[model samples]
Target: MRDIYAGSTEVIVWLGESGPKDHLGEMILPMLTADEIASLYQWHGDRRDLPKLAAYVSKVVEDRRKTGSAQDSIDIFGAFYVLSALISGVEASGIQELRHLHKSGPILRGFDALMQPRWWSRAWVVQEVVVAQSVTIRYGKLSAPWKIFSQAASQYERARLEANADSTYPYLKEQSLARFSRMILEIETTRNDWNQAEPVGLLSLLRKFRSRSSSDERDKVFALLGLVRFWRINEKKIMPDYHIDAIKVSFETTKSLLASVGSLSVLAGTLRYSECCDSNPSWVIDWNYPPTTNEDTRLFNLPWYCAGGSDGLIELHKQRVLKIEASYLDEVISVGEELVETTITRMRPVIMDWTKLCAQFIDTRPSFEHAHYIGGGSVGDAFWRTICGNLEFVKMGVNTSNFATTTVKKGFRKATADGSLAFEQLRSADYSHRRTTSIIGGFWQESNQPDPEIARRNAFHHAVECACEGRRFFVTKTGYIGVGPRNMSVGDHAFIPHGSQVPFILRNADRLVACQGDQIETLSSATGSQPTYIPAGKHAKAPEQQKVCYEAHSELYFVIGDAYVHGVMNGEAVRLETQAFWKTTSICLI
Candidate 1:
């Protein structure tokens, strides 16, 4: 299918108002009413005195043409020119006015039709649209080039982002962007980026469109093989084979990715106690759904830190096992309340509770009226950096005097506070009782200057939310603070795999089976207090009567996803003073 689509000179797409149930895709030229077309052009085009709308659209089209996109297609440009004029007009007139306008009913109706179509959300559509040479979208006889839709979506995205700081810049609002059109724009960009040899990878694409629908789970992997770069696969293409089991596709993809991607950043997994998820091997990526958890910057581990350093160890075994050398960190002894509620309204109280938890271990509080991180190594600094994993602050466009950094030591280039702004509010969350004090505290008026405290708080709040999504705030036995997946247990160990960008939490897989397996016996190992397990079927003979009695101590571990432990984020694990308990060892993950 991909080869056919890729070889085609032009592909015509029947974008019906709805799915197959209405048979909109089968509509002929007569199906589109002349009145609907006229109504759309009038409401979206130059109605009267709004020259700015036309000017904005013209400028957007011109810029797109400069980028060699639909440069020769005047029809495409004209279509986009009118679409964005109205979509942007949504911001000026407000969504309520444009959405409810009787004269503009056709365009809104068109958007309504475009929103819920089955074609837009299907996983295979990614391959069809991306591989094709030229594409045209048709709603009955009313047709518009695919370039027009892509341009319109990109313009809406730009306007929506710009409107954030300026409330009056009524260009476009979020609601006006068609849901399916977003998928088109994304695939176009993916194709462009991949062709240009950008840093895009199969994992990134898989997670980006993971929500896309597909009847066969195997198609999720097969559909992407066409677009995935050969370099990411060790120059070996993953050919499709219907004979292969759907489960093996995941295992093969994971193993291939882990082998090729170098870093263990591909090792993302979860034990979703809340949902009825697949019982896949802990190392395999279940692509049918996205990762239950995300680490730094939505699973793209930021390059600022190298937690595991230069050491690299990867070993694939028979029976679906992965072994890697990791440095033992510590055990999670205490954890704060799980923050599952994701909303700005609920964020304050949730963070406040987490702050209180941090205060419990590090009782002493220092004044951070101006400084965020202490120059000397302090538990307070670790607590702050740990919770704010992947501050992602560099590109966040947040401005503050407190965005300050200093070298913690003379020869060490790494700063104590690399990329965090430890504002007074963040510092006082533990001790200050002023819950609703204005961000400036009436002090900014004295200087007659704006306060960036609100900005800092907003950024920090967002960072904490990103770092803790689908995860629980945990404190280790040695007083290290961080967030881990919800399934991280009290006795589970944290380790920084030699080549991984971030630390991870993994527990003895055999022990997990002993505790939770349907038929298993937990026994004490002959060597001290280490856990030993023996499996027995529910229908099998009694354990005493079993002929094969053997102490099973499988060193296999079920990997809990990546972590954001503060101290070890920047190669601290590699440079740690050699200790007996925190030494390196080979860990086998199942």
Candidate 2:
């Protein structure tokens, strides 16, 4: 199907209430109606519609011109006439307005050449390479790169000279470009001063932009300042070895000399020590030991130094002090407690599931080797006891309900007062917290499981656990009932503790009755433990019977593989990514 306005050349025709075409003879009425022509100009944001309208106008103009009609009678044929007619029609139709016309304005303006048609016939972009060669002819012998650039420049000159006997270099009119080129010639001039201060080219560029008179130019100057600030803060972090490279002075050094010096010039002295500085030097508040009140002067590490005196340094210090004193001081004190609770909550299911599974695996191992590591003598029993204790706690809905609230309220003070040695170990002078220690103990024992293999398997297991907990694990009890809410029952869900009973009641079409409570005795294997069942009432509706929930088993676990390890021997060490015990399959039994 061909588009209505497919051709490169466009013609537009518009009809208003007072169109000139109303005077046309009845002979031409069958070929075109003014109403139909007006409807053709009605369109949305489309540029194609304009051309379609234009084509119809061109036909009318041709018809009038061939008839020897006066140019005044043919005003509809002019490009601007066609444009105004189309705009007015679109506005009248309520389909569009002039404000929406900007999108196609530039394209429409370019179409003025279309009236001639011949000039725009060829494709615009031609295949040609622009060869740019910059040469820095230092006062003495040029460096290899400079020499090569000079040679290329000379060759370009020779080729131009050959191309024309009478030649001129047009760029000579820009005297700054010539000055820039000559400066590149003096490379060796500042070779000795290169490392003594910041590069002059960078400084010069900053100065030029900083001193600009126009608002746009000043904006660019501020942008440069912001970039410098970013570089100063992040240089050590992003490129720790950047300062190691020696300065390579060349004739191009003059470009550095051209930059105007500002506040950044003061940074040159401090920059000397930046190579040894830390990227993120956190402030440590030793709450246990107050700052020596006896001392009049105290020296502390500041990430930035003052260019002037104590006032400048103190002002910067006060800004940070006020900021912390205003908001983060209390927040910092509070976050430790918050993090402690958050960590436990996040690790809850993981710890539960892992510990339980470790016990299960220990209980049902196919061979002695599987049992030897986690099993041995009391280890197996100790693990089983732990799992049972925890599982029963869950089935009984026994958790630190008020315990968490109390802990958070008490804050780190509890941990501090209780003498948790881990906190003190973290505070050891020999331990730099910046270099993180993954394992407080040492590396994982070489289980029959391959190192990477164990990690990959454990990751999949952990992901599954996280997914299940995210969706199904209940955070609150609403429909719960029991002797102190001992259990929860979803229909068909297995019960862990024996003795819990579920009672179901039907209440017409509008409501249902349910009751949950403890059982007289738990179903038990004389040798082990049994899962309990909650019976439904005989009067319960068939669908209502489905609402009866039995107590669910508490099954969650954690295996202890060392999470991090450091070595005192030979300064060598290994770390296991997962601190888990279960390997999932016999292939991971190693």
Q: Which candidate is the best by TM-score?
A: 1
What lDDT tens digits, residue by residue, belong to model 1 across residues 327-361?
A: 88888777777767354334546666776776665
Off by over 4 Å in 1: 18-113, 139-142, 152-185, 197-200, 232-236, 269-279, 292-297, 337-341, 366-384, 393-465, 510-554
Q: Estimate each model's TM-score.
A: 0.66, 0.12
Top candidate, metric lDDT: 1
Minimal lDDT window, size 10, model 2: 326-335
Clash count (model 1, backbone only):
0
Question: Candidate 1: lDDT of 136?
Answer: 76
- lDDT scores for all predictions? 0.53, 0.20
The root-mean-square deviation over C-alpha atoms between each candidate and the true structure, in angstroms, is: 12.8, 37.2
- Cα displacement (angstroms), candidate 2, residue 578, comes to 43
Question: What is the alpha-carbon lDDT for the whole of candidate 1?
Answer: 0.53
Query: How do the residues 92-147 of candidate 2 rate in per-residue lDDT, one tens digit apiece?
Result: 11112111222122222212322222211111100000011222211111111233
